[model samples]
Target: MVTQDGATVTARSIDATRDWLERNLHSTSIIETERFGFFYGREQALREVSLGIPIDGVTAIMGPSGCGKSTLLRAFNRMNELYPNTRAEGTIRFLGQDLLKADPVAVRRHIGMVFQRPNPFPKSIFDNIAYGPRVHGIRHRAHLAELVEESLRRAALWDEVKDHLKKSALSLSGGQQQRLGIARALAVRPTVLLMDEPCSALDPKATDRIETTTRELAQELTVVIVTHNLQQAGRISDHVAVLLAGGVLAEFGSTRTVFASPFSEQVADYLSGRFG
Candidate 1:
């Protein structure tokens, strides 16, 4: 039997499971989780999950609804702490220290997040992108302008909004707004970017734009995205981590490997549309 905290899979032998993890857990990992768990008041949201996020490339955390995908993503930057009566245990190492133990503000500066929906501040496009760097103490106009333009360009939003820098960010389309949100996060120059269903609210064309931007961004930054769309994950992610009901990490490996040869029947079923 293989057991992780309270989660168990009797069908998988402990030795086999260990072997599989050893093979997939890359040595160049930038973020490592060790028996991590999170709680909300009296309820447990994540239980004894452990995995490695590579230094560069996109990593998709996928599972069914209410499987703690977003919860885990939030935990990385200690955003979970914003909720009352919440707590986390175990280690989430980034830069060789437990991120859970680090200051939330400091952690957020290094690990930026984009939400499921476009939520730009009711400010101009320039202000939206410049917000983070300004808060971080870049007071010079030229510097802020440089950061804003660089961020927008990095998010693939510069060409579309460059001439309308003073316009309200809310004026953009759903996809443009989402990309604006991404640019805002990038302005802080985070080493890692966390995206939670970033394309869920957009149309196909917008989703395609976001997907393209994501692939390009992965070339320079480590991106950890939470998504339920299996095909999207397969198309963009370098690694895939499948979380089961109750936040159990059932399978994790390169996207190609996991999609091609799932580790267990449950994983196979989940990938095949037989079950979530």
Candidate 2:
């Protein structure tokens, strides 16, 4: 899932899914961050960092291990708040609403997250995708069916499982399960999609399919992804941010620029394989 082009590493881990997103995705700028930081217990996981996420494009967060990439991604939707003794400081605005101050429920409705692992529900695929709409008061059977179809279509999984809507989601392959997870997230109609290394577990062919799906989805939703694969970042991202120790944002710019000419020595070193 990782590739090297001379001095640069082209991360292919999430390339397939991201590529899919780029193709059918619409572009929008739905979130903005300003001087954000997060803490686990008394330890700081992220420091002052700021970035603008375009509404309809893929923005990738990349860095070496323990560089706060995941922590910063969680702040966009306040996912950090779920853990005990976790806190965030600074401003993260999702469509002008401050995430840190907003109700967690409301924030979740606007920003949805997909984890590294595929976690489909034990129930049927139809039920898994319908769960969100049902929770929000959508009860008509017709409405639920429509939502299910649309979500699955958007996730590029309709053709694969259309005939078996009643089958348990766990019956699918790892790649299919991950796409189901995405479809479930999409069922809520979130304005922002946050993915944490979504393709870390799939084979090359499956990964390719997911990348293409992500590119298409970007046409209608904003996406923020945290990935360690540098090649993957370059292939699917319109913008890229490089994180470093102490949660510092070493460099941030267009993917072309960040990969071609990193703004700092540290970023250059990391990308060049000198040191992280």
Candidate 3:
């Protein structure tokens, strides 16, 4: 078992868990991109973009559509590989590992993701959370139960459905399903969680819950979220990166700094609703 004061890691953990990271890890960062670019066939989606994602914090990637927000987010786990003829250039480092060269499946396991919309399986709620751990060779029923319960609790959903573990996940409300997706990701005990517009499809109350859960999750996990809602970014992020036209990383800094004083006129204009 392992735990960090602010982070709720896991009931059991490996040597590389957050609580066991080197004392000086914060001096580096959770991940860094250097001259990163991406392409789908002949079309370029990102270009010469570079930034650092701090560990165990909420870093919001904010931009209008077609600004490469999702492109950069997917690059962290090599999800870009799903498309034929897709390729990347330059490097993305996760701690000491080269993300572009890392094993895709393993990378995804260590850095889980929650999509723009909820996507729970037709299986029971319990099964949705247990599936990932079980697939990774955790067959002990007692351990699976404990993991599912802890994950759901961390996602702020356990009490709502504790007595309905066997109910079909599809039967739950949209907000509940989204929380279930988060719980599913947490059940794998990842160190980082990537959210691609996680609350875009939810109502205001659901969006608030997701934002709240993300803030809490950041205590133990690095969270990178892509958002079109600048207000949401300001509310939940410690840092914000503004991607601009031509796939450029126009500005990046603390949310307070970036929102209060964007370095670029383009970013400032976008923030002020002048133009995207």
Candidate 4:
């Protein structure tokens, strides 16, 4: 049973959940949320949600709008604190450390974020990617250059903008700008990257490139993306977490299994385009 809270598993449900868990098992999650809740000054958002995000994997939080997808993603890096009076209850642990109690600045550095739209600073492309390293005290010009190039290559934007490193980042196309955003986040060498609708603003081709970059980055870093696009989730995610409205985690498992055989009626309807 679920009512403005998380699931209440009975004996029958437990067996089905266990079967899915067995099929989806991986290394212990880099992050775990247990009975987690969130609030904006007593206006509750998420409620009693539990999830485990495996290390070095791409886990997509799939749901319709207003389903707490972004809220949950922001919890990873403590980004929700940006709002006044916003707070969380229960626990969101990263590497066994409670992120709610962790230093927000350190947490952000350890887990970078990319937004829905490309948000590059009004600086040269090289400087944008180098800014994170600089803030972390990487001052050597040679080292900064190396990091810049590597980050760009990883984001798949190196060749396109290699000759124009000194140009303003805003001068790039929408797709390039988004890739640059990814590159900037990657340069920080985050343990986990949180992306909130990174492709929502891009065209089809740009979305494809971002998907490719996400997959490649997952090879080395844990990635958690919040996207409403089910096809995109299936294409880029190893595992999927489906959140129902009112902050309930309706279903979660391998991307294929979740998409192929959703655990609940709402999940199945969402997947079938019956209701967002």
Using lDDT as the measure, the top candidate is 3
Q: Write the per-residue lDDT of candidate 3 for residues 1-276, one digit (tens) a residue.
A: 111222223432323544444554543367889999999899888999889887757999988789999999999978988999998999998765788887777778778899988999999999999988876777888888999999999999999999999999999999999999999999988878999999999999999999999999887778999999988998999999999866889998999999898888889998987876
**Whole-model lDDT per candidate:** 0.85, 0.81, 0.86, 0.84
lDDT of 1: 0.85
Model 1 lDDT per residue over 158-252, tens place: 99999999999999999999999999999877778999999999998999999999999887778999999999999899999999998888898
The number of clashing residue pairs in model 4 is 0
Q: After superposition, how far is residue 87 of candidate 3 from its true place, in Å?
A: 0.8
Better of 1 and 3 by lDDT: 3
Better of 2 and 4 by TM-score: 4
Pairwise lDDT winner, candidates 2 and 3: 3
- In candidate 1, the residue pairs with backbone N, CA or C atoms under 3 Å apart (3 or more residues apart, or in different chains) clash, namely none
Judging by TM-score against the true structure, name the best candidate. 3
lDDT of residue 50 for candidate 1: 95
For candidate 2, give the lDDT of residue 266. Answer: 90
Residue 195 lDDT in candidate 2: 92
Q: How far is candidate 3 from the true structure (C-alpha RMSD, Å)?
A: 4.2
Better of 3 and 4 by TM-score: 3
The C-alpha RMSD of each candidate to the native structure, in angstroms, is: 9.9, 10.1, 4.2, 9.6
